[model samples]
Target: MQRSEMPSINTQERLLAWALVLVCVALLFAQAPHGGDFYWSDSPRHALNGVFVMDLAKAMPFDDPAGYAYRYYAQYPALTILFYPPLFYAISAPFYAVLGVSHETALLVVALHYLALGLGCWRLARFWLPAAPSLAFAALVLWLPEVAFWGRQVMLEVPAFAFLVWSTVAVVAYLRGAPPRWLYLGAALLVLGMYTKISVAYMGVVYAALIAQRDGWAMLRNRHHWWVAALALVGLLPLAVLTLKFGQANLQSVTGVADAVASRTSWQGWVWYLQQIPSQAGWPLTALGLAGAVMAAWRRMPGLGFWWLGFGVGYLFFSSIDLKEARHSVFLLPSVTFFAVLLLHTLVPPRVGHGAVAALALLVLATAGLTVWTRPVFYVQGYARAAAEVARLAPRDSTVMFSGYRDGSFVFNMRALEGRRDLHVMRADKLLLGVAVRRELGVEQKGLTEGEIADALNANGVHYVVMQPGFWADLEAMQRFERVMSSDQFEEVARISTPANHKAHETELVIYRNKGAVTPRRRGIDIELKIINRRISAD
Candidate 1:
């Protein structure tokens, strides 16, 4: 290889990288949803939280009281705002204020995060690969199905990771003698990442390992590093306090008391995450990442070694947790993609014609771009229409019930779309389980009888019930639902059916109206009744 030819090769690579960046951006915009309908259950809830923050900031009345209706398990029903750290919501709040609180505005916030993710990954990759391959690597990472799927929605994974990658880049730069300021910047970004999602705290382990390998125990002696560490800790103090106070409440809010019923020691969680790698990261990239890790180990490449460590430890740590989810693998994707691209560069023989290599890279990019563009949008189409119907048909200020685990879409649409804060929207299951409700209604601990359930609904002034068949698939639930439907106390109001799709629980929305308030019959003679009978007999 001639030294003179190196400059020309570098120039060509730089041009290719920028071109890939543009292509990735174009694909993302093409795929983004332009409507107010949310695609995922959590997205609408998260967006509503942002709106909650926005309303509070502006001194406006909280627009959605239904958001506060559900109880976090046996604990008293409280606002849902505290379940997650507020960084993502805080950043999104202003967008809601300016753009108007809608799914489109929430998506705008996600798109900004998406752009940051791509740029952050490109910058991080530059530490190892040249300009061209680093940009190409960023494009490939962005095109991964998980990234594309989550990036298009208002979710925490992509936004949190954008800061995490940039933080990694900053730490690497400081270690390579960029400047002391880089270390502080790295520390600040790490704090932001933690605030975004607590899962990113594992990055600190990677940072510690990298420093130890580079300078043995001596790096700890550096005052600048200690100051940076202190700053990060101070930055995290508020979050630490909040977590200590509300951590259990937050966990209960999401998982509920059912976490106690589910098997926590099962090996299925570990297996599930292992199986996701091939689909989450395409098989081609997964294979390349494995090869890259082996080659990097053989060559003793410290940078790649640190990445492998981060990826391995993060994967194992999350997999060991009882709650298994594919989205948790998102943070590990950047490291995996980095190694995959490194392997690609390594395996491409220097003797191979430059034009051939260029063509292969372009081919991969084109295929990925097309896949992302054609990917199905998974919005709940029925909820928007159902919400509109409810607003139009149901009397203003009437209590309405939603019976499902995924009721966020309904709550979001009723409040955000219809702007109906006067309506008391409740989840039937949550209402049944809520301890406060039981105390208020003087209901029995053993559970409500079919008659008692109807009595409780009427007593609470619930005028309408929205039932979804998929939510009542369990035998007991279905039986209860049937009993409620058969009761003479309620009449069928409206039924709306949507086109069949796998994303929603039920395509049919059945609305039932309370006919007349019926006094509930006591199942057994109460002590008060017994006391009255004895007094009358004695008299």
Candidate 2:
């Protein structure tokens, strides 16, 4: 190849990269929920929090009187504030104000972030791949089900990733000697990423490793390195303060309360993530990524070692954590995709022609399409209709108990979306009931009998109960449910049944009204009766 031809090749590649990025952005927008609603149990809650932050920013009351009200057993009886980094909410707040705090508005904000993610991916890939292939690779990474599906939601996963990738690109530019300003910019972005989600802190580790690899101990002598560190510390101070204040509650929120128990350091967790990669990233991309990583490592490619390190360290760190989730490892997706693009570029020999390169690009697009096609469209369906029904049927200022696996969805939809702030939707699980009893009723009873629970519900002014079929799956819960049904203190009100779909579990939300109690609060009577029965049985 002539040296003069290199400029033409580079220009053409740059143009193709931009063109591919635009196409990916268009596809992402197309898949987003424009007019229709897509449901996630967590999204409405996050959306509500964003609106709350927006209100606070505007000097309005942070709490909405007409919003769904639930006692935060973890805190006080307050509007639900998802214990997450506030950056996503802070960013989405203005959109909430302009869009009237609807799901569509939240999704639109996410769509914008998705576009930003595409651009970030392109810039990050350009460090390794030529301009044209880098653009296609960016589109492929953006189109991955792991990215696209979450990118459309109100969750912080994609938003944090957007910052993390850009930070990565800026860091690369700095290391390559563009300017010291890029290093500072990278620090700021890392801080921003941490604000969005703490998981992005892994990038800091990757960045340090990259520096250590490039300059060894000598990199520490650079004044610019010290400046970046100081800037990052300053940026991360707010998050550190939040961590100190919230402590374990914030950790529990991110890892999930249930995961605190279920997650363990096991190969099973590692295997689970490994299995998700092929589906999440697509088989073709995963294979190519593996090949590229091996090739890059075999040749000891400069500045490319961080990609492998990032993936390896990220996978190990996340998988080793007690709380394991597929999404927790999503930070590695871009690294994997980057390596995959490199392998694809290497596959076509200079003599083998551009057709081979085009075929590889086509293969990536096809795999992305397959992934999108197979991925579930909604996280939880039929929630909007059920929420509307609750809003319509239930009396204003009445408490509605939700006894279901997906109670969060009901709580979010009824309160967050429908603006049914007058209704207090309580999850009727034993753990929740225990907390409610202590907080709302000033009772500290544990292991309350079914009758005792029923009495407490009546005394607490809980007017309606909504139970799904899955709620009755537990033997004890089912027994209690039957007892509640047979009691004269409650009457069935409404039954909402939604057929199982590709994305959502089949649900039967049964609403029951509390019939006025014929007797005084059972308080300690059931416990006494149980003690007496125990003695009698022993005799």
Residue pairs in candidate 2 whose N, alpha carbon or C atoms collide under 3 angstroms: 66-421, 67-421
Predicted candidate 2 versus true structure: per-residue lDDT over 78-158, tens digit per residue: 233434678888888888777676777877777777777878887777666666677777788777877777777777888
Model 2 ranges off by over 4 Å: 1-19, 29-40, 58-82, 247-272, 350-353, 417-419, 430-445, 470-478, 503-505, 517-539
**Per-residue lDDT tens digits of candidate 1, residues 262-377?**
22355664576767877777777777777877877788765465577778788776765555567777888777777767776777775767642573476357538545554545
**lDDT, candidate 1, at 252:** 40
Models, CA RMSD each: 8.7, 7.9
Please identify model 1 stretches exceeding 4 Å from their true place: 1-26, 32-39, 60-79, 249-272, 350-363, 366-377, 434-446, 473-478, 500-503, 517-539
Clashes of each: 0, 2
As a whole number from 0 to 100, the lDDT of residue 33 in candidate 1 is 54
